[model samples]
Target: MDKNKEKRPSFVKRFLRQTPHAITMLFGIIVLVSVLTYILPAGSYDRVLLNGRNVVVPNSYKIITSTPIDFLGLFKAIPLGFKSAADIIFVVFAGAIMFAFMEKSKAVENSVGTLLKKMGFGRKHLLIVIFTFIYGFLGVAVGYENNIAMVPIAAVLSLALGGDLILAAGISVGAMTIGFGLSPINPYTVGTGHKIAELAMFSGYGLRSVLCFIALSSMAYYNVRYFKKITKNPEKSLGKGLDEEGISLSKPIQEYSVTANNWLVLSIFLMGLAVIIYGVFNLNWYLIELSAVFLIIALLCGIVSRMGATLMSETVLKAVSLAAPGAFMVGFATTIKVLMEMGNIGDTISYNLALLLQDMSLYTSAISMAVSQSVINFFIPSGSGQALATLPVMLPLGETLGLTRQTTILAFQIGDGISNLVNPTLGGLIAMLAMCRVPLDRWLRFIFPMVLVLLLMSCVALIVAVATGYN
Candidate 1:
């Protein structure tokens, strides 16, 4: 027993070290299973009279399989690459450049810092929670640009509140993800799902939004508990040697004088915000026209702030340079979409899952759909893509099972929202982490449990739907 006890800790340490790679290995197993299942056919059994007794037996012993891809099929699938992959890459590049400019200028940092100082966040926890929630809400309502702004604000507030920077980063991500998760109007995920599924334009999207609101509220409550504990015991909370990192903001805030250089920075940020607002809100202008406006703003600000024409050209060039890495990440994500198409992997996987769900009892089908979609979400990460990819298969299966399409769609939305809490690949996560200066490990410590809680809540919600049936 003593020997076993000593061995257990080492085993656990090894398991923990291997778990991240395990996720990748598990995904590979899933893909292999998907391909085999898609390519192999099981013989159908039929009832027959054998001698004097009725019996069931497989008559046709040959397995049959059909492949979706020939040269023609591959050619046809290529156009989807542009639609699914290229667009995401281009948009991400545009957004990143816009953000880098905002960050370097200190517009995001100063604006957020200035606001938090006025709120007296150190003395009050309620205001901080409310303000954080609002920041998240505005982020979703405004989409990506406004969401990016919320990150710095959330981080600065974390410093003001005397909370751990890492915890603050997690909280920042939680808020942004909440907004992204709940979005009723955004065409990317929920809205697109509703349209593709032929559900109402607004549908019960409002219901999912309400659920996200509840989830965010629960998260905030937990954060308050932790924040209060930290505030009461600063030494324990800050820990030893955590202040050494250059990223740590516990140092005294020095007064910064806004010079010509600073004003030049501020103008670039304000112009970016103006362009984003105009583009996203559909503010009665062409995208090209809006781009022109930003260009003019950049030029005029540069000239007024004593940035010579040559320097202005260099600044634009430099901003584009900084955006390139983000563009690459986005491109890599798009490449996954392309590969899935090439493999017909998405359709095959969805069809198999749908088939499995269809075999379950009716109530089970609804709950199973939620559980299944939630599991799939850990990989896809894009709620709209998951919805689009799976709904075609699941919706037909749901109809055949006599389940309400709306209910199944609701299940998908719930599953999608809950998974976002831990989806590290999300762009909003990087922004939030950068803003709050939190490492990934610290985030998982708090957030992983919270996500599990939300997952349990989702199960409970689905059970209620199963028990009551949809109105």
Candidate 2:
């Protein structure tokens, strides 16, 4: 036992020594993207205001003067990223502290544990399905950033279910991203693409829904398989360092019991979720409103749990402090997007990608559209941001290449969605990983196979979409 404990720590030590911190990785990517702005020719497209949002004018591309990020600008891009992504950054910190305080009353554990029991432990795979699929479509209705608060709860549940942080992230934020990436409602990608393509809103959801289901299934299977592997053998866990505690969150079976207080806290949480959902759909709430809801939930949990002022203050501080690293990384990851915009290379890259799809067979052109979009997704990770930058150019370009506007949008979703699984530039993804305490490298390694599977599915979907004359 002594030897085994010593060996585990050494392995953890080695892992930490070797693993690149997410912030460091993102910082390097920021530098790399900044450099590309210097190397790539700068370009811009004329934009026209439509319904208060600027719509990219198709075929209005022109090469502009190159104004790449200089040395000072490189550092400036980070704070710019922080300002731009402040809403999401706030969500990350808010979600963490809220969950931390809720868990302090042991309320979250008892409540979720009770549900797991009702789920019959035998049906834990169903839990993965519900978390991935249901959560995914919820992402469709409300963007994934709104669902950020659920990740820590899912991570705790995943740990209780004999899975690691990667699995937690996979089912929660990971599945939700599928919805955001492929949302037929055009909450971001589809919606913006439709407006740009001049297609009727909700025009091609049949094919998009099919894509969403298949994509969700692929992710669900991957998450379930991972859960089974880790449960049967704890060594299969991919998290390193202190995160290796896959099953430690669970108490001994006999010791587990939910109290009335647990029920109260759970009710508060559920009601909070319901309110968030209502506000999002009805009031059109975003980051600030969502963060306020979570903060309110945390304070209510503190009140119901009857902690003193001093204890409450300390708890809130601790949760926020614990959340600091992930929050910082969230802003850090957005730096790449900031640097790209600052360097004025976003439209230039889009113009060049449109040029690549100029002459190809219809089916091949559709897939190529997706391929090119996937490449651009690396720099501009936001679905709407990417759509605004590239689709105006690609939409008209698609017309010349005999691809439908709907088909082009389909390719955009495929390319954007799959790459989001691994895009280092996305603040939402970085925030999820940070919340789960899953290192960036570990997640990339864990999700690579699934991403490859999803990519294959995306390619096949794009080809089929074109062949059927989908519009």
Candidate 3:
């Protein structure tokens, strides 16, 4: 053997061996998306504002000879996305700060102990079920991005229950995604689609409720199965990939107890969440209102915890610093949308997808619509955004194909929703994963199979919606 021979690592070998950082992977996606812009011609429909949202006009698409993104625009997408997502970023930051104070109070942990004791569930499976339903209900009745603040609390609960971080994400992110995807009365997706389909808002609740139950049950069961697997073999724990150190369950110093201070903190936090839900549903509260609620929750928690104003300020600032990475990850994910917008290919994609359904059978068209909605979601990730952009084209297409309006909307919402679970372009899920220190690759590995399952369920539900003429 030659002593001078060096085992130099090949570039391909090293690249395949190393996990790309989240931002690196996201940028690669952005690059691929940007390249597609030049390949697809720029096209769009005129839009009219109804109730403050710009809904696309059907049959209004026209090709535009727009310039493809220059090299400068590639880097500029980051700042553009930040501008577009400013409100979202602020609320997420506020939520993080609020949760930081709540973490300091240790109220969430103590409250969980009290909750477990009160619920009389000695087994952990029930807790998993409850979490899936609780967060799933929030996703059903409320919104997705707003619930991100609760990720840490969920993580702690999962840890305490002897589960890994992935279980926490599955119960929270996976369940919420499913709930919102299939929910009958979900204000954002179903509500928006109904408006576009010209059906009374939330009129077809019966079928959606049944579909939602099936999806939620599947999510809960998956979380329980995952929890059992990890707990059975700690070696299989996905939490091993987490970057943050010192993440483990707290051992009760003495038999668990909640003090007066703990109770006050818990009340304040719960009340704040209640206010958010009510505000979102009734008062149409959004980013600013949500941020204000977080501030109130934090100040009250700090006061009850007897932390001085200065201490609270420092704690929150420290928290903001810790969460800064997650926030930036959000901006990176948002950049994907920003790039698509920069090139004006979103409508082109939608138009082409709509064309695919023209020659298909009714049921085939329905399933094809669901698949198209999933594709559309990659460009415009928001539930309501997809409704505004795609539903106009889809509803007309469905009408032509002898499909009911509800069937069309069902396919739109489900496809748009199930895709969000693994869609790296969704800022909220990406940010939440960053907060939990879960790697994107591992999350996809853990959740992609479930996404496929949910997508299958979604397709079947669409078929049912068509067969029953649900409307």
Candidate 4:
């Protein structure tokens, strides 16, 4: 090779580098779903508010005249999605602001470095396992969106602990998604699905707990493996070039003291989280309330750090500028659902899929229901929303096929939970990816294998549930 001549990049490398941006991918999805409106029949189910949540009325579905999205209407759905998802977008922006303040204060860096030092470099990877379980528990306890504010902190910790952005997101969002998917107590999916099935609350706790363990363990393993690969060879990292320019593990770890100011900042962050958890479990707070909690915490941190108003304002503006793309991606991802609703096909797709499960064998029907739920999740990313929309029809179909309600709920849990790992419509996933500066295409490529394994494991669990006649 000529010393001064640059080597040509390989074709595979060129193609990988050329992968479409997350926003572009989401836009393409919007177009595809809009087209689906024309090909798939338009239909809907009557909906009523139950316990302050909108739920589809059981046995109320009917085919309606098609209202396919036209070209102009397709473009209109983007803004419509933005309007509907505004709360979440605001949450993302607020989180970025908080993270920026934390970074500026050295609060995140000092705290993470100190924690890793205590763990020792040899045992550092253990942090992944620990945080994975912690986030997983939170996922089961609270909903996924409620944890969006935590991603930036996780990213900081990941980089500090000799890992990359993907690993950071994996331990946080990835673990939460796993927990959300398999949680027996996740009120959003499990609670709502059981209600729609008229089954006792958290009725299948034993099987679900076992599945949760299996899924989390699998995720922890994946995280460790990827961390090791990137640690050994930085070029293997999806964040290779990006990591060098921003946060780098090669940077020396500073000894963070437990100063009074550090304590105040840390205490404020922890107290805010505790209150948020309390509100979620007790007060039933959602996106807007969660965003407020973090916003308050950010302000408190800035005050404790003693940054003047000018500096604080500048910091927030800069953080928001960096996070702007992520905020937009969240809104764009929501357009998939917007388009589906505009075409009146969200329920139609579910209705038709449920109709197909009428004659399947118990095992097959159980697995098929899970698969259908996964597909439905792409359109209705909200756990409670999917439960309300699909479980009504799935429960009746499960009954007709002699499948236990518990088995049906199991299908719903797996279907709704696992797909979040890859669903573009999931705002939290997009926001987390954006925070870490990882493109959605790269994330899909990295996570697709793990998703397949998780899905297979879920199928096996469903089979066992059917065999044991789980109730």
At residue 375, what lDDT does model 2 achieve?
Answer: 90
- Cα-based lDDT for every prediction: 0.55, 0.81, 0.81, 0.83
Better of 1 and 4 by TM-score: 4
Q: Write the per-residue lDDT of candidate 4 for residues 312-358, one digit (tens) a residue.
A: 99988888888887788889898888888889998988988888888
Clashing pairs in 4: none
Location of the lowest summed lDDT over 10 successive residues in candidate 4: 242-251
Give the runs in model 2 whose Cα sits over 4 Å from its true position: 1-20, 243-250
* Backbone steric clashes in candidate 4, count: 0
In order of TM-score, best first, we have 4, 2, 3, 1
Candidate 2 has what TM-score?
0.91
**TM-score of every model?**
0.67, 0.91, 0.91, 0.93
lDDT per residue (tens digit) for residues 1-471 in model 3: 754456666564344346566777888988888788788899889999988999999999999987588788898988998888777777768877888888788787777766666665467899899888998997887777667767777777777777888888888878777777777888788888877777898988887888889889988998998888887898977677664332343655245578889989988988998998899778978878988999999999998899988888888888888777777777778998989888999999999999989999988999988888888898899888888988888888899999988888888877888888878888778777755657676787678667778778777877888888877
Please identify model 1 stretches exceeding 4 Å from their true place. Answer: 1-106, 144-146, 184-186, 226-274, 281-335, 378-381, 424-446
The model with the greater lDDT, 1 or 4, is 4
Error of 3 at 3 (Å): 38
How many pairs collide in each candidate, listed in order?
A: 0, 1, 0, 0
- True-vs-predicted CA distance for residue 274, candidate 1, Å: 4.8
lDDT tens string, model 1, 91-171? Answer: 434443344344445544555454555654454577557865776676467664345544544555566556666546546
